[model samples]
Target: MRHAGRALACLALLSSLAVAAPAAAQDDGVAPLPDDFLWGVSSSGFQSEGNGPDSNWLRYTEEQEDKEDVGASVDFRHRYAEDIALAADMGVEVYRFGIEWARVEPAPGAWDQAELAYYDDVVRHVLDAGMTPMITLNHWVHPGWVADQGGWRSEETLRDFTAYAESIVERYAGLGVMWVTFNEPTLYVYHEIDNGAATWLDAPWLFDRLARAHSAAYDFIHEADPGAMVTSNLAFIPLTPWLFDAAFIDRIAHELDFVGIDYYMGVSLDNLTAARTLTGGLADAQPDGIYYALRYYANKFPDLPLYIVENGMATHDGAARPDGLSRAEFIEDHVYWLQRAREDGIDVIGYNYWSITDNYEWGSYTPRFGLYTVDVQGDPSLTRVPTSGVDAYAAVIADGGVPAGYDPVVPESVCSLIDPPLSCLVPAS
Candidate 1:
């Protein structure tokens, strides 16, 4: 482990970066990120693509009384051209989306060519739009057949998932695509247990299965597409990264080419507002925690690059956030910290905003996190309305990042537990 000298090395790198990197705008603070830094948008197959497939999430929504029905969510399956165009218009360089397992393989060992071709069209469209495709193999939804065969509980799941990953990678290899073996595997385990798919006693076994799946997939993805970047993104649970990352990320750290972090909210000693995520309510925003998240991962995996796989604020039904934070401000605030992270010598390479349009958020359509907001339940047409975030994001991408001298809309929290003692002792500039 190179941790012994990491702190001093990081300090030295910070000083060197200050003198070496040129500022894009105002010189005192935030500097322009590298020209090759990836700016992208993200969406998952299950959440954005309407026309339901037989899957665990569909069943979860149907069986649970409180869960809202996911009826033709934003109809991305039919309207992807418009959606991709919207993202391309924003000048994004990457388009990250999932290839739905349930939709592609409805039955065990059976692949649907039509569904596969639909994804082919989507990828080709993205390429035509000049965005690199980032394909996620699994995003918390598997075929109902897989779910019926014990889901992640049985050891058999590991083998089946690896096979599924191999098939997908073979199809998309050499297409200049980035691969995410599994999306937020830790949260995948949480949702499985939370939805009664598994029990608390089965948590460790589930984690092991996911870790094994990712490790196996990593080898094959690289075998098929040499020099490919592969990772299973982790949802950054502020203040308790160890609690969340321990079982999953620790198990597959060596296999990762880059650290993929999905950060949304932060919690402090005085503010436990992040609890809202548990109840499907909009979590209170803490933009500065993003800086700590990057710093933490950079310190732990000093040799690997970092990517913000997903980061965006959520609103309830297009309503103003209770904290009065707009999506536009959220984008600027987070990007400002990203620039700061890079200036401090973090090997940060890319960022993908959570989504292109609002869709069914897990079991409910209440929380909206999209650059172009959509009224999933109320509007039959599913029109994509441009939010203030659209203009803000376009400007951010055009300028290479938030303007220099830019400060976050929400100030850093006191004694934030994002990185505990280190974060509290040495607050970021």
Candidate 2:
């Protein structure tokens, strides 16, 4: 962790230099993106697919107080086909989802063929819909057996995790699948600490183990799939990336084929929306902050491409956001920034909206970020109601990006803390 902090110091200094550097010329209009730019939607197995095998998360939810019962969440386990078709109908180019470790390997040294076959079916459906399948190998849920062995705190769990990763890559490698070895490894540690799986003192050891797991899995994925691109997406924490990326991303920096970033909010002296992060509630929209996120990564990993593995707006239980930003405006506003980043020479290859449908958000289903809203609590049918974002996203994809001279519905924040002195000193246009 100390070594990582040194690396973070270097990165922080590099970012600080942006304050002295001149901002790139603001383009008068956004141009058409490259033909291969991927437009996709994202979801995780534990968050969306219900009737799941027992795991650390399931146990945590069971024991925790005041958590919403995540019963048959959007029932994606039984209704994936319908959901895949919904995405296809919107001309989505890719479908990013997770293959649950608990479901496929419920016990140590044991495998479940039925659950594996279910994931096979899900992948086939996505391909049948003429979309690419981006599979996340872990989304912070492991089998109860692993938890019993002390979760990520034990060396034994790390060994087992690598084995599971190899098993999954071996199975899905040939299916033209893109792989995410872990979803937000930093956040994974935070959640584990929050759930009593580990203590703050254990964070350094846990991060080391996660880095080892991802590095081993990266080799296994490529050895099996050859052409497969792999990443463990980072949940971009504005202004303080060094605090989050130091222990994980810095360790596995060399292992990544591309940088996977999930940017959902921004902080500023005036707008303290980031405080909501502690509660998993809807944060205020910071559309322009995404440009800084992209630019930051573009500078950090100049040779590798950047992908927005997860980006979207969350509303409280399908209702409009308190800030009055509509789901549609959020879509257009962010895409506008994406185009700007591209025009400024950022090599961004893909953008996957945070989710296709609303599902359990870690502890509760209250923070809804899905493009297609679902009534997980009230509707027995689990109806998939299209938000205005549906049409907005489709149009963005069809037109290659937001049209020339488009203006964001939400204005850029003043003195944004997203990238510290850089963002504050030289705000993006």
Highest TM-score against the true fold, candidate: 2
lDDT string for model 1 (1-429, tens) is: 334454455465555543222233335778888889999999999898987689999999999998988889998999999999999999999999999999888888899999999999999999999999999999999989899989998777888888888998999899999999899988898889999999989999998888889999999998999978998999998765766778799889999999999988887765678787676666678887888888888777878999999998788888888789988999999998889888778889999998889978888888888999999887888899999999999999999898777877787788777866566555674
lDDT of model 2, residue 236:
95
Global Cα lDDT for candidate 1: 0.86
User: Which pairs in model 1 have colliding backbones?
Assistant: none
Q: Report lDDT (Cα) of residue 363, candidate 1.
A: 81
Q: Give per-residue CA lDDT, model 2, range 18-68, as digits (tens).
A: 422334655667777888999999999999999777899999889888676
For each candidate, the alpha-carbon lDDT, in order, equals 0.86, 0.87
Taking all chains together, each candidate's TM-score versus the true structure is: 0.93, 0.94
Model 2 CA deviation exceeding 4 Å by range? 1-28, 279-281
